[model samples]
Target: MLRFFFSFLFVQIFLCQTSIAQTDWSKQLDHYISKRDEIDAVKKKTIKNLLKDLQSTREEKNRDKEFIALMQSVKAYEYFVYDSAFKYAQSANRLAYQLNDKSKIAESKSKLSLIMLLKGLYTSSIDTLNTVEYQYLSNEKRKEFYSTAYRAYYDLSGYSRDKHYSEAYKKLGHFYSQKLIDEFKEPSFEKLLGLALQSMVTGKLNQAEDYYIELLNQFNLNNHETAIVTSGLGFIYSDKGEVEKAKEYLMQASIADIKSSTKETTACRSLAEIFYKEVEIEKAYQYILLAKADADFYGSEQRKFEISYILPLIESARFRKENKQKKMFGLIGVLVLVFSLVILRQLQKLRQARKEIVRSNQNLIHVNEMLREASQIKEEYIGYYFNFSSQYIDKLEDFKKSISRQLITKSYDNIEQELKKYNSKKERQRLFEDFDRIFLKLFPDFVQRFNQLFDEKDRIRLKDELSLNTDLRIFALIRIGVNDSEKIAGILNLSVNTIYTYKTKIRNRSIYPNEEFDLKVMAIKSV
Candidate 1:
């Protein structure tokens, strides 16, 4: 059914082109409104009286009165509202049929067909035109019949793309266009409009511009003529690549359409496409929506399809913009989370380190107290040992004096007996015993502590528990910061070679290396 409709439309277009010139006046919607407003203002009084007379005639219910009223109504609304115009035209047809007025029927049907074409129902327009019997039409009505047919085909040609149909429609439109020209003898507004359309359809843009501009200058164009002229200029400037001028003219046409209450227009759609191509997205979207609303209101399927192409492109661009923003926000959120985690982990580690430092400070404070007590003990022991040594020296001095007096008295037996009683080994033994007692008092657990540094087999076992062995005495001297081997040997009453041998043997048996043995021994706990 759709194919048949389009095919019929194309055929009518071809036929109409064979007899007329095709002009796309839809572009000049603004020019039409500007012209229509002027015409309506001038005809306002006449239209008002006609409407009053029609209402009275309707109330009277007389055949002649009714017939005249219906015709008047059709004529009055022809430029105001197409649907109202069509409705009145149909009323005229019905009245003429009842009155058996064939001429009136033909005129009414012709008017109806033209309105149908304006509504974009090409097949219906052609069918309406076919219903009008040509023989019954008046000479003026016959001319109107051809003129309306020419307009219908002209409009159809604009929407058709088939090369064969396009060419045929163009030729037919030119033929009828010339015939219409023959009907005009002078340079009137209608003639001028027809001439401009003819020139434009034939691609003679300069001629069309001259005619249209001349018409606009000379006469106040009606809504339809203004639409035709301005839209033609817009097309011409667009072809010349004068984008601003073209847009200006198209905008003017659109404004005219708005003021004139004309919904069937191409200017808004054209402007939308231009803005879209120029990447003016917001303007494109605004214009496209307007165009779509107008197209839907106008009820033209072709215009609806044309608008459909641009809507999706703009919507997709909007969606992509929104989607990109969402992704960017998501990435920012992820980055913030990762950064927060990094700071949290650093804070945790810092807290743990602070705890460890506080614990270490507490342990250091306890160790410092132990060292202070040990220092005081060492000082008191040293003072006691020095006092005891001083008293023992005084007693030895008195004993020496007694022995000397006995020897001088010439008693060889007494001197020999005193000398035998005071043996050198026995005196040395008493001195060592006193030293051990003072040393042991200072460090009671010295033997146990010293032996802990070596393996069981390498440990020094003293036969006398009261006295330290040679090696123990050497390290003990080292623990007291007395590391000199000669000083140690003199204090222990041993040879320097024996002291050295004892030091080397103990060091070899120690868990610590040779070089670090003395340091390790010094590091032993004082208590």
Candidate 2:
């Protein structure tokens, strides 16, 4: 009975030990699964070459050895492609079974369980792991099995709505998580990856980010490992609401996944959703398209479902925005055209106003010239009138003195002769000569300018240079304001009828109107 009790205690301790070494399998797998598309081209080539070498080998032992190497190669693609990984793992399992190798069998089963878990078949993954007997597994194989089992239960707990089953799975997953930590005897890349993922699962984002940063900086990581670290950083920053930083890390992870030929990266899709929310439609379309292609290539139902929800929304928004911009531009073009026409109309009006201003200025200049000419004519006439009046007054005074002298001396006959000299025809002739000289002095070009108004045949010519013709005398008198026909006839010792006839002839010969002829004559001035 004591032996039975000790055996039971030992079994309990062994069971506890197994639980302690198990990890959060879902998160560990997800870290690499999100970068499944990112596979190194060179490594793929090398694996193909190894497979070619395996096919060419004739010996069974050589084929088995190559199969082991091929298994390692296919393990690289396990998280990337479920069916391909399953096939390779099955081949490796068969090869190990033929060799009676328990360690190799356990390793292949652990790998198969990981693929099953990635497909989200948690119960199937746990069942596959249970088929491997833990007591016979190598340390590494045992750790892998426990890791796969823990991830399966953790996922089950997360999806469970029932409180009792959820709590039970959670407690089981926690025990496996602690075991995964305790089992790592030394620091390693795998250990760091497990720690980072476990932190993320527990909502310890800060610790997760720190662990991922360390993995990136201190270690020479594989393409898959690099993608995992970068993607985790993106998730942490995204949760913290640092969108720009999150996008940067997510883009890096996405690129690495593509380069490494990873089959399942959600970083691109996450960025697409974020850009859509921010109204960056074009960016959303670009990222979502790449994600859609990836999901199509992956042939994964979950990825297809997630992308379906947001793709149409972003595309519709982009179309609406483009149409709105086109209409807005059309309106702006119409407004600009209308504004241009208005400006042209205003310019034309301004030019017309300027032309009118120029014409008005020209009219004002012509009026000013006419006023100046009139002012000059008045000044010349004023001097001439005063001199002529003074000479006439002196002649009258001399005549009066001569008549009185003749009366005092009793020379009636002499007085008569003297009076004739002073006031008769000869005296009138002298007075006319005096008037002509004064008028000619005042208006030297008067005859020539006046003749310019008439036809060549009608122009007046004087008989003597010192005397005026009847017609010349009439117009010359009019020029100096002796305008009345009677006054002009008396001054020139002619009849009013003759004077009227002469004035009529001059007016008829003039270029101007009959009424304006006299005025034009008066307007004439000295050269």
Candidate 3:
């Protein structure tokens, strides 16, 4: 009886201790979850303290103290803010080099490699890792080196996705990960994580799941660790086609990441992909945009690349769905509107008949006014044409009389001079001047309105109001409805090519585009 009681007590104590341990982790998780919204503020406060310490250490001019300060700042910023983390890591590296400390240099470079990996600089991360001398690194530094190298290769393998290169990258990743695992004792977080990742890479989903579950059970993880573990479970479930379970784990991981202010993460992106495949477009779009924002904030090119494929697909699907809904609503509205209009039409049949008679009378009156205005314009132009013809006839008669007098006197020089005075070029110039004057009289604001189409520097300025330049003349023809290049060229006594050239050059110089310029010219009101 005594032995049995002792055994029962021992069992009870062990169970209680186990329950307390699990409860502790649960409380920590709850605490972070509650403070998710305040994570950024908390991070800022922590960084502020770190900077204060850094400044004090810098003022002391002790290289070792400053180095430690910079490394602390780097660690503080690594998961939340990569740019600052990278800057501090770089400063630490330069200081290490300056101090001629091989161990510090190796440690700093390893930290830099991890930051580079976070920043999607995979090749640079690998290159940076290669520069570190393993012999000079302490055990802890070696662990970091192996871890960075492992992640760099693993991520590079996935990013490539090409069978040829991916296989080689995967092998290197396995090599480094195994090295990392060996650096740790058994049942450690680092060892378990490495084993889980290896199982995942090797296509042992069940084994990977077991490893992750063991990690969760054996450890009271912080926010970062929780994010990592949950994210792994999310991927495993996703691969196993357990969509609901995948989403649950991914959501928890994403929430934890947010609580920790971890911008460099895959949780949000994984959630987006799963939602996208589930055809929950709104959820997918929201998560993808969130993922993109985090990637942009983290400055991770790899994350951006991963998102690029899904984001556009989600946006397009969303647009198509919205357009479909809009079209359906529009069809329904049209049907209702048509039904209403038909009812209204039946009730107002007699009233509409009366309105039609009144509307016809109004349209007839408007047409009469337009015809009267057209007749008046015709009369003015015709009267002006007859008077101009009479004046030209008189001038011709005068020219004939002068020529006859020259011939009778046998003054060949005077005849030659008279012929030269009546040359085609001079006659054409006079004709153009007359046309310009008459056109301007008919539309007084044509030049002013045409100038408005161009910028101040490009506007055409006439030497005199009585004449137009070639460009202005071409547009003037267009304003008068002589839009065809051949017709305008015939009127201006120019080749069709020259007319087209002038039109193109003027339109190119205008503030309006080519297609709109002609329309704008035609829009000019006629007096």
lDDT of 3 at 46: 91
Best by TM-score: 3
TM-score of 2: 0.51
Ranking by TM-score: 3, 2, 1
Write down the lDDT that model 3 would get: 0.80
lDDT of 3 by residue, 1-527 (tens): 99999999999998677556434543554566467558878888999999999999999999999999999999999987777888789789879988999989889988988998898767667877877887788777787688778778877888785699898998998998888776666556777787888888889999999999999999989988999999999999999998777777787787788888888889878887887887778877777887888788878767776776667677666656665665565566577885655544443664465456556546655665675586588558757878988998998999999999999999999999998887777877887887788778767788999999999999889989878888888888777645446778898998999987888788899999765676678668766
Model 1 clash tally?
Answer: 22
Return the candidate ranking by lDDT, descending.
3, 2, 1
- lDDT (10s digit) by residue, model 1, range 1-527: 99999999999988566533212332343355446556446556676788788888888888777777877776665645555566667677767777888887787788888777776667667667767776687656666776776666666676667777776766666665666678656556655666676677778888988987898899887765676667778888887787766777777766665655456677778877776776667666777787787667656655665666667676555445545655565566567886655555555665576566556546655665566587678667777778877887887897788778887787788878877776778767776776676566667787787778778887778888898655676777776645446777888788989998988878888987764565456546545
CA RMSD, predictions in order: 54.7, 54.7, 27.5
RMSD of 1: 54.7
Best by lDDT: 3
- Write down the TM-score of every candidate: 0.49, 0.51, 0.57
